[model samples]
Target chain A: MNCFKALLLLLLCTSLPAVEPVKLTDDGRMKFTPVFVDGDTRLTFVDFENPKVFRLKSMDWKTREVKVVHEAAPAPEFDPAYSIDGNYFSFLRTTGGLQVSLVIRNRKSNEEVVIAPEPGFSGYRTPAIAPDSSQMLFSFANNFGQDIFRIDMKGEGRTALTGTKGINIWPSYSPDGKKIVFTSTRDGNYELYEMKPDGSEIKRLTDSPYQDIRGQYSPDGKQIAFVSHRDGNAEIYLCNADGTSVRRVTNHEERDDYPTWHPDGNHLVYVAERDGSHDLYLLPLKD
Target chain B: MLNIGSFKTKTCSGIGRRSFLQMSGAIPFGLGMSGLGMVTADEVDHVVAKAKSIVFVFLWGAPSHLDTCDPKPNSNSDYRGPFGVIPTRTPGVHFTELLPKLAQRSDKYTLIRSHIQSAPGHPDGGTVALSGFEENPKPVKPNFGSIIARHRGFRGKLPPFFSIANGVVMDGGRRIEAYGGGEMGAVYDPFMVGASETGKVNIPALALMDDVNPLRITDRRQLLQQLDSVPRTLEKSKFRDWNRTYQQAYGLITDPTARQAFDLTQESVKTRQRYGQSVFGQSALLARRLVEAEVPYIQLNYSRHVEAITPGYEFGWDTHLYNFSLLQDQHCPIFDRAFSAFLDDIYARGLIDDTLIVCMGEFGRTPKINVRAARDHWPQCYFSMWAGAGLQTGRVIGESDKNGEHPITRPITPLMVGTTIAELAGVDSQARAEMRVLDGGRVINELL
Candidate 1:
């Protein structure tokens, strides 16, 4: 009986996910919209330099060296996304007075396509590039709540993906490109939902009373990582691709948000606030 | 006028004569000197004082009244926005889902939804909100904090009035003209201090003496010993005055208890965690410390700038665009947690009875959703949260229309806010008359 109990204790301890997260950056500045690029050798993210400037920065994953991705401009740019082949990049740039335009630039041609809202207090948010780089998905305010919309590579052929009664945002395509997962408040309170590429057969992924946002598919498309506030404060949480077996990844009292999946399916890189200092950390997960 | 002299001296910590004098210049003893000459009123009528300290939490950018405390669940979606209303601890009082924590703590504070501002734009609105008067008429009035600070006079090492923020509050590039002493002259300007999310307190005036980092110095006695070596080159009487200024500066810089009051590290790990580690959160904690230290007034700012999405600006409550998104993701979460913790701490420390706390913005956002699906400036109606200071609690003080477009009940003006604050802080009508401040201001009788 003692030997059996010892084996059970060992199994339980080994099965528990690793609670210790390794700190990656120590500069302690606010960072947002982190994405892995260049075959996972570099990380691209937005760094807020001041209230008037947000610079897109790329870090060499190996040496930890950081550099700006673009020359300084008057308008602040953020919410960056890159095409799967790295041939195209998309981001939101503020024009003026609550107006933002989604700019998609083709690296090969240095040509750009811009999608802006009608003149007034309007802007696009969180552009997600399709896997084939043929389309871009973003959210805009419509009919009193934000709705997801997709535009082709040339910023044409706009189509409403999901028009709900509440906010529907942070849409990203699965690796396979057959389905899209996003956060929505249609049912009241932010929750994760998935639907086909054509916005059909929508299915709820999370049912938390609090917010569950920033959902992203793992590189291999088997898992999803997101930020949820169900456990009191905002923390990183993970669920299966089909939204089963949800588990909390971070338990800190401070906020842990903006979770982006590492190229490897077993880890996530997220912005974590610890002891009042916000920095990026690599959190490992157990199957 | 006393001429500042050039005297060479060095501290044990290697602070040179230039740095020492620079540090002294940052002390603002000249302002305090002027304060000392003001005649105290011999027979002024004084209101029964309930609060010893006042924390004027200035939410710089106006927040939407309908989306927050005055949620109109019965209204159309255009007016109600995306958030659902949640029941608060106070019966029939409801807030949006974005403020669950504050909703649960409703019993701790009174909510006023019938407040209105005189100005629509940020700079003018901010001036009106802080000083209870418009700026265009010239000779802008002193801030309520300034009025209270002058009435109380200087009594401690810490400045009687402190504005805890990154810098002077601004809207775009324009600074509110009535941010400080106003007509009272710069001498009565509240001392400026900035607190980072990590509890790193920065005295901006002290930054003039960058070479002398008083915050980095742990040994107060050693620093004081080093300061004693300055050469006394002036005549005996002049030297005596200079020495008094020096001692005042030294007392503020090297007083361990004074320094400790600004130190967030002195707080336990759990305590700091409760504040949630944001700029506004840590600043709220610092304001609580200032209150505990008996500072007469603290202007705790939410952000330095009014624009929420503008680069280089901290996120303020002005939600002209992406109002619902910003409120859901950033402003509301940070505010709900930090403010709830602040209220809990104030009550836990038994400071509620003697500390008057007022949290409000310059104005409120538009009741009707704008063309961009966001809210814009609306001076017609707004809301404020009041607690502590032995006042009533767990009740709604005023009412707004069903659309939150106008105050259906008696409109509470900014002057009424200033008058009520002053009344609670013991600045009665006679004191206001004597100071030539808050002219024709009347207290919100319903609050009393």
Candidate 2:
């Protein structure tokens, strides 16, 4: 009887989802906007050098070794995304003041295309390249409200996909490029919404009274991962592509935000604050 | 730089010994020197010393009054923004949903909604906010903290005034000229200390030399032995005077009591967790510890810079772009958890009665949403939160118009703020007259 009971306990513990920290940043600087790259072996993210400087950094999950992706610059460079073929790279670079420009580079050709915002307090936020690398989508703020816009590889043929009265940001394309998921506050507070690549057939994904932001579609396009404050604190949550079968992934009292899906679709890399220190962590999803 | 002990140290303002001596000669050092018996609460005349310590929570980069504390829910969507309002502990008072924790704890403090400033930009506004005077005239006035520090003098090992931040607060690259002592000299400047989100305390002025391992700071004898080895450079008479100042500076790190006061490791895991784990949160906890140490004035800054979304910058309340998103995702959540924890901790420890807690920014943001769908700098109106030091709690002291554009009540200027803080901290009108500071300032009678 005792042997049988011990076996039951072992099976239960082994079946539980395992979460592992990618790196322990003890310097009190924040690491945010993690993106999986290099076939899931490496992750790229933004790191705060000081209170005034942010740089792009990449680290190997297996070796736990980190490297700076871009050399230090006066302005901050962040929100890095890579095309499916790894031939196209894109990120947002702050010009001056609050204005930011999206830069897209063809790694193979060594050519770049830059889309700078008009003058005044405006900038591109969270640029996500399409799976085919044909176009790049990002959010820009105007006098009325913020909306997502998409531009081709040559920074031409710009199209505004969202024109709501509130903020519509953090647009991410599904693996097949059939659907685009984003966060919007048009209905009231921030909530996740998914629409066609052409901004048609819009569907509200989550209806939480609180904020639900930074939505990213999984590699398989079967589920979406996002950060929601419905429980009074920011935590990671997972829901189906159709916005059903919602389940909480993290329940820490502190914040667990900025969820980015790994290439495997079975895991996520995110920024979590534990004991006042912010670091990246890898969380395995349970089926 | 003065090479005392084993390492070279600079003053918080980077003033050298000669400059220090020159300033000391100009001002009477008797009141500021150490070894004087503690000035008891009863010793102050006229105005009672209701508060023995003042924690000036400086929220740099003005926050939008409509989005956070002073909500205009009934206004148009453009003016009101996208946030919903919730009722606070004080009846008929509502704050935006971004500040749920603070709203719940409204009974613990008083909220003032009719603040106005002269300067529309950060640099000039910050100077006026800190010194109650503009930077246009030569010899800008001393910061409110410097005024109280000079009045209280030094009562213990810790400096009378402390600015808990990574460095002096700045807007972009321009440091606030009025951040430190103005005409009063650098000797009256705050002792600069940096506290990380994890509660590690760093004294920038006393940074160790590269050769010395920081872990060895705990060993006083070893540190002093290295200090003794430095070759004498000054003449015997001058060296004696320099040595006295050197010992006093090093004493801050060597003294056990002082070290304990700055050490966040002494706090329990639960207490640290309560404060949340952000730089501002940990700094707020450190400010509480300084209050316990009887430091006369502590200016705990939210961030050193004013810009929020700029690269290489910490999130200040300057929400020029992405105002609602940043507030929901970053600023509000961090502030709600950390500040609520601080208020609870201080009250639980029975320190509220003698600790004047004032939290506000240099100014408020624009009431109307801007072209970017975010708020811009608006010196016309803002708000402040005051608690402890015998303040009437659970009440709204002033009112703003329906649109929150201007004050419906009498406008509360920065000068009045300095006067009220000084008066509560035992620096009476007569004392202000003697120092020739806050000359025309008057206290906010409603707060009393």
- TM-score for candidate 1: 0.79
**lDDT tens digits, residue span B24-71, model 2:** 244321222111111111122344568999999988888888999989
Candidate 1 docking class: acceptable
lDDT by residue for model 1 (A63-165), tens? 8888888886567788999888888889988887667888999989999988877776678998999998888899888666678998899999889989745
lDDT of 2: 0.77
Taking the tens digit of each residue's C-alpha lDDT, what string does model 2 give over A42-76?
Answer: 78988865556678888877777888887755587
Q: Quote the lDDT for A41 in model 2.
A: 71
List residue ranges in candidate 2 displaced over 4 A. Answer: A1-29, A71-75, A201-203, A244-247, B1-48, B85-87, B207-251, B305-315
Looking at model 1 chain B, which ten-residue stretch has the lowest summed lDDT? B4-13
**lDDT assessment of candidate 1:** 0.77
Worst 10 residues of 2 chain B by lDDT: B4-13
The positional error of residue B360 in candidate 1, measured at the CA in angstroms, is 0.9
Model 1 residue B426 CA deviation (Å) reads: 0.9
